[model samples]
Target chain A: MKISAKEVQNVAELARLELDEALTAKLADQIGSILNYVDTLKKVDTTGVPPTNHALSLSNAFREDVVVPSPGTDKALANAPLKENGCFVVPKIVG
Target chain B: MTLYNLSIHDAAERLRKKEISSRELTLSVLERIAKTDTKVKAYITLNEDQALAQADQADQAISKGIARPLTGIPLSIKDLICTQGLLTTCASKILENFVPTYDATVIEKLKAQGAVILGKVNMDEFAMGSTTEHSGFKITANPWNLDHTPGGSSGGSAASVAADMCLGSLGSDTGGSIRQPASHCSVVGLKPTYGRVSRYGLVAFASSLDQIGPLTKNVKDCALMMNAIAGYDPKDSTSVNECVPDFTATLTQSIKGKKIGIPREYFSTEGIDPDVKNSIDQALDTLKSLGAQCVDISLPHTPYAVAAYYVIAPSEASSNLARFDGVKYGIRDMEQTELVDMYKKSRSRGFGLEVQRRIIIGTYALSSGYYDAYYKKASQVRTLIIRDFKAAFESCDILISPVSPSPASIIGQHSEDPLKMYLSDIFTISANMAGIPGLSVPCGFNQMGLPVGLHLMGRHFDEATLLNVAHCFESATDFHTKRPSL
Candidate 1:
């Protein structure tokens, strides 16, 4: 039931958060306590009761694909952190 | 005259009457932001020139006798809603300097209505934290007590309104983001039914549950904002096609014979403050006097809502937040060797600690090895939680509960513990999961002088009933008029 330091590191890796060793230790304790609190659900007996999903009893709500010319490209790139050649510029993927 | 305190309705009326020009009102709000925002830290960015220009245009349109419901009302927006040509960071570093090109559906609607855009308000980074303390920019302090935190993730919007920095503002509510802060600041916030307002432009947190809503000083103002913003949008498939009722029409409906349900589950535990409990009781009694009947109902799965919400919300968030990697519009990583490295480095450098924490929790919950037991199980529980609300609604026309377990906590109080922070949303999350309208208004004050919020929830798209019940209650008391002495 306890999320240990190792498990915390693993979760961090899965989450893509770069936690320092000290922060990892702190988070392990916190996550462990939280998971323990969440464990209260284990005591319930769901039996034949079906689990719910959409609260409004809705289903199959999807919009049709219709392309509309977006606003000006200049307006789009006006606030980019870095832009080049009308596309977002990022650091090279392969070094 | 302070432009910030002018109600949207009043501002619109004044523009129509040529009493005060939109240019004057816009300048007033812009000047107020310049004066008070440094202390309130309510806005992440201010669009003074653009807002003033829009106000001028609005004035010109009105001079020609052109009219719209929200025309000329200068309003601010929460950072999460996308605004074209404006920096729309959700108070997170990931999109810190990113400007969106496309308008969210609400933004388009507001523009069509001629509502002036003042700026974007601060929020908890990626809408993760209960207090605006998690905002990467600066902590949004309560207008009443600057040392304390304002509730989040619409903390800045709520703070801006409370401090008279804006007359009306828009906020996104995934789980109490709109209502909690509205309650803390003693303002009126309306979270319309999930699909009642479009989610096309909101940065998805819990995609199935998130909706944009209005935060205003009073109920009538809320109705006017709702009238302008509510309705179907083809872009958001989930946007309801139901007729956008003239919400203002229902304000005068008699609450007589309405069956108000108070879920015993909400008050059974020690989670609510005593003053809030008393205020709710007082409101209930006032409803009784007004000819409404009070009944007790049970949402037995109430306890499981937070557990299921944290699971499903994070599961959806994990997928939604994946778009923020360096390959997209945000800050990109400098060095990367592989696709995974691209994601890792981009995300690491872009997002803040809290957003990263959630993405991690969500990723773990939905990971292949754990999906069956964690994400799937949580989805199953989400169904049951929805069923709980459905079963409760069948017994009452509207449900009443506390907005938060307690009033606003001091800044930095629970910032360190994510679980404890998540628990703060316990009372408000279910409404989002159910995709229904929930309104939070000031009921009374706790011992510490912080406002206590009473949540009123209606059946799906039944904002009329909710407003009527709330309107009736507001008339019976002066709670809505009470303000914090800054």
Candidate 2:
């Protein structure tokens, strides 16, 4: 339950965040305390209890494959920070 | 009485009778906001021109005899709910200018009924924190005492109604966001059963727990808002296919012989302020005097709720917020040429400290080795919490408790202490974890005059009982009538 700064940095990296040393230390302490508190869940006997993924009991909701009108390319792309002809422009991935 | 202070029911009746014009009502509210919002900082954005234009259209509709129940009612929408052509910042800088192309389903329904949208109100950044202190903008002050914090992340919505800046407001409750603030501001806030109101356009925080509901001047207005916004929508897969009831129909029903459960665990929880306990006990006594049966109940798993919720909510939040990678929408770091670097730079800069911390915690919890220990264990505890509510409801028609362990804390009280702030939600989070309808109505004020809220929670999809019980108590007391002398 004791989250170290190294582990916090690793998790931050996995979460696609860049944390400085100060923030990493703070997060380690805070997250460590939070996790320590959450560790109380271990004391409860959840024997034979199924994990609840959702508040309500719901199943896979299916619909007909009928095509509906989209928001159209322009409106959909309105909030995009950068855009190409019609698609979102992001930093290139492939060489 | 000032036009701004008129309840939605009274305002609608007057509007229909042609006694008061929608423009007059809207202008009065706008003027009130202009006069008081500087001190309260309740609104993030005020739509003055558009609100006046809508009021004119509503007047035209009334003249044509096409006015609906909420025809000219001015509503302050929480910033988390998307409104087309309006900035829907989740009080975060990342979405400061990210106007949605479409309105949230609730907004669509309100617009169809000719509801006048006054503006978007402030909330915690991405609805994460309890106080509006976490907002990228200004901290929203509790209308009762400007120096005190309005319990949030729906602080602005609650403050607006308390200050008479708007008749009613819509707010999203993930974990006590609506109810806690409503309690602090001495307003009525209802968090309907999950999926009762469509979450199609609500900004995702914790999907399983987040529910949008109303913050209003009274119980009747809360019910009226429910009628406007509650229904199924195909756009949100989780939206239930159940029939939306006339939420106001049962308000007049008697609560005689109704079983009101007082959870022993809730009262026994550590750190419950003495004034809050006294106020809640007095409210229970009032219910008993109204010929209601008060029963003692135990939800043993109540203590584990906050811990479980933090894990489950943040874990889901990590996945939900992963969509905000600065590519499709929101801000992007243009300087980075590499995709990975761009993602890191954009997310690190785009998200606030609390958000980043949550992402890291969630990521760590859901990571390979820790999943079973943290995420899975917490989820199992969530099941136990839900079962506790199920058992408690079997013996009671409705459960009553304090909305928060304490009344509104002073500003900066929990600003530096994350764990302390998280504990403020202990009394309100279980209802969400159980997916039941929860309402917070102003019960009484503490010695300092900070309002205390009486929490009423009922079985899933049974908001009628909760509203009816709250309405009955509200009728018996004048707590809801007391206004901040702002």
Candidate 3:
């Protein structure tokens, strides 16, 4: 359950976050303690128990394939940090 | 009494009788906010001009005899719930200036009933923390004592109602967000059964656990708000297709034969403050005097709730928050040349420390090798927790306990330790895990003069019974009538 700073950095990379050494170390300690506490769940006899992904017993909700009014490009891009030609502009992905 | 001091029901009656105008009520509330908000720090954005305009429209509607229960009544919204063209920050810098293009379903419902929007209120960033201290903006102070926190992440919603800045407020609860703050502020708050209220436009935190409900001055107002917002909506796929009851109808009904379950695990658990325990015992005695039977029951998996919730909520949160990659909306790091670098820098800089910690924990738990040990194990434990509640409810009408382990603590009491802050939600988290309706009603105050809340939880989609029981308790106690001298 002990999460080292290296593992913290690796997880941060996976989560698309960049953490400095100090924050990574701090998080390593904090997450380690939290994981240690939650390790108590290991003691519970959940043998043959199904995992509950949702609290309510719900199935996939289906709706008629009817077209509805969208928020439209103008409204959708209103909060975007950068945009051009009615679309969001992000950093270059192509090499 | 000052106009701002009127409860929602009282204000609605006065508006109906033409004894007061919406403009007058709204102005009075605005004046109260101007006077008290500096001390309480409840509001994140006060919608003054728009609120006045909405009030005038409500007045016109009233003149035409088209006034509804919430007509002309002003209310605050937790910042996470989208308000069209209004700032919804989630108290995070990432969304500091982001305004919604459409209303959340609850906001649409509130607007449909002629409810006036006072403003957006502060909450922990993305509704993450137990204390409003985690807000990217300002810490919301408990109205009872300015130096103390209004237990959060619905701190602003509860504090605003307590301080008379607004008659009622809307708040979303993922864990104990709404009820814990309501308990601290001595107001009424409810977290309706999951899927009872539509989650469309509510900023996702932990999708399965998050639910929107009301924070009000009294039980009846809570019911009134429920009537306004509770129903199925096609916009949210998880919204239940069940009937929404008139929650106020059963308020006057007797609880003479009601069986109130006293969960032995919650009572026997350590860390419950002496004063809170005393208040709950007295509240139970009062219920008993009113002819309800209190039965001792066991939810053996209660101890595992917080642990299981931590894993499941954050795992889901890590996935849900992955949408905030600085592409569609929210802040973006324009300086980063590479797309992946922008995603990393934007997220790390935009999210706060606590948010980052949760994301990392979630990512680690859901990682390839650790998924079975953490997320899967926690989900299985959650199943056990839900089954435990099912067994307990079979022999009891509802469950009662302290909403929080203790009354409102001083502002920095749990700031240093994240685990300590998470433990504050022990009593309230199980209801969210079980997807049951939970109500927090003012029961008594501790020796420190801070308030304690009596928690009542009912079966899935049974908010009516919870409200009725809370109303019955409210009638027999004067706790709801007491106000802070702010």
Candidate 4:
């Protein structure tokens, strides 16, 4: 549970976040304390217990494949920071 | 009394009798908001023109003898719930100006009832923190004491009701978000069972734990709001297909033989304010005098609730928030030279510190080496916590406890310590972890004159019993009648 700065950097990179040395060090301590506290779960016996992702027991919901009208392209793209002819514009990907 | 001070029950009755025009009520509340919002900062966006237009429409409907139950009732919406064409910021800068093209399912329901939406209220960034101080916009103050917080992330909604700015408001509780704020503000707040209310169009937090309910001046208004908002929705898969009951049908029912469970663990927990403990003890006595049996119950896994919730909620948040990556909508970093860099920079800058911290924790928990140890372990522990409730409910009609360990803390009290802030949710999180309905009703006040809340949690989809118990208590005491003078 000892979260190192390197570990914070690794996780931040995976999460697509750029953390400075100061924030990374701070997070290292914060996350370390949190994880250390959660380590108490290790004491519980769960030899054959199934994990519960949701509180209720629900099965896969099915629906017809029929098409329905949605917010048109214009409205859908309204909040985009940058947009092209009709699509969202992002930084260059292929180099 | 000013129209702003009228409870939804009384206001709706007066509206039906033509004793008050919807426009008059709307204008009065608007005027009050204009006067007091500077000190409370409860609202994020106030729709004066739109609200007046809606009120006018409601008046026209009344003239035509077709006014709905919520007709002309002005209510505040937590910014996390989508309102078509209105900015729903979730108090995060990332979605600072973002407006949804469509309404949340609950908004659609309220609109159907001819309800007037006053505006979106502030909350913690992405509903991440307990105090509204984490808002990227501004902090909401406790109406009772300006120096203290109106417990959050639904702080603004609770404050709006307590300050008479709105008759009722909608807030989503992921952990203790709704109930805690309602407790601090001394209003009635309920977090309906997961799946009891649809989550469609609610800005996703922890999907499994998030449930939208009402914060109102009294238990009757809470039930009325529930009657309007609680039901099945085909749009949300998790919404229960079971029949929705009339929540108001049994509010006046007697609790002659009702079994009220007192979890010993909740009372014995460290850091429980002595004032809170005293209030809860008095509340139990009040219930006992009302002919209810208070039985000792144990949720043995209670200590693990906060730990399990932090992991499960943040893990789900990491996946849900991954959608905000400088694309489609929300803020985007335009200066980045590359796509990957843009994603990193946009997220790093767009999200607040607490939000980023959760995302980081979630990411680390779900990462390759740690998934089994953290995420999986947390989910398993969540099962145990749920089982603990299932067993406790077997002997109790409803469980009563303190909504919070203490009243609202000072505005900046826990901002520096993340773990300390997380621990404040002890009393309220288990309900969410178990996905049951929990209600917070004004019980008493601390020495500082800050309101304390009595917590009542019930079986899944059993909000009626919880509301009945709260209504009975409110009838027996004047706690719910005490309002903060702004």
lDDT per residue for candidate 3 within B303-322, as digits (tens), equals: 89999999998999999999
lDDT of each: 0.82, 0.93, 0.94, 0.94
Clashing residue pairs, candidate 1? A15-B360, A52-B383, A52-B384, A53-B383
Model 4 clashing residue pairs (backbone): none
- At residue B459, what lDDT does model 4 achieve? 97
Candidate 1's displacement at residue B137, Å, is: 0.5
When candidate 4 is compared with the true two-chain complex, its DockQ is: 0.85
Steric clash count of candidate 2: 0
Which parts of model 4 have CA positions greater than 4 angstroms off? Answer: none
CA error at residue A64 for candidate 2, angstroms: 2.2
Give the TM-scores of the predictions, in the order they appear: 0.95, 0.99, 0.99, 0.99
What is candidate 3's TM-score against the reference? 0.99
lDDT of 2 by residue, A6-39 (tens): 9988888888999999999999999999998998
- Residue-wise C-alpha lDDT for candidate 1, range B350-445, written one tens digit per residue: 777777667766777777787756666766777777777788888899999889988888888987778878988988998998888999987888
TM-score on B-chain, cand. 2: 0.99
Per-residue alpha-carbon lDDT of model 4 for B1-486, expressed as tens digits? 579999998999999999999999999999999999999999999988999999999998888989777898999999999999898898988899899989999999999889999999989998998889999999999999999999999999999999999999999999999999999999999999999998999999999999999999999999999999999898999999878888889999999989999999998899999999999999999999999999999999998899999999999999999999989788888888898999999989889999999999999999998999989998999999999999998999999999999889998999889999999999999899889999999999999999999999999999999999999999999999998988
TM-score for chain B considered on its own, for each of the candidates:
0.97, 0.99, 0.99, 0.99
What TM-score does chain A reach in every model? Answer: 0.76, 0.93, 0.95, 0.95
Ten consecutive residues with minimal summed lDDT in candidate 1 chain B?
B332-341
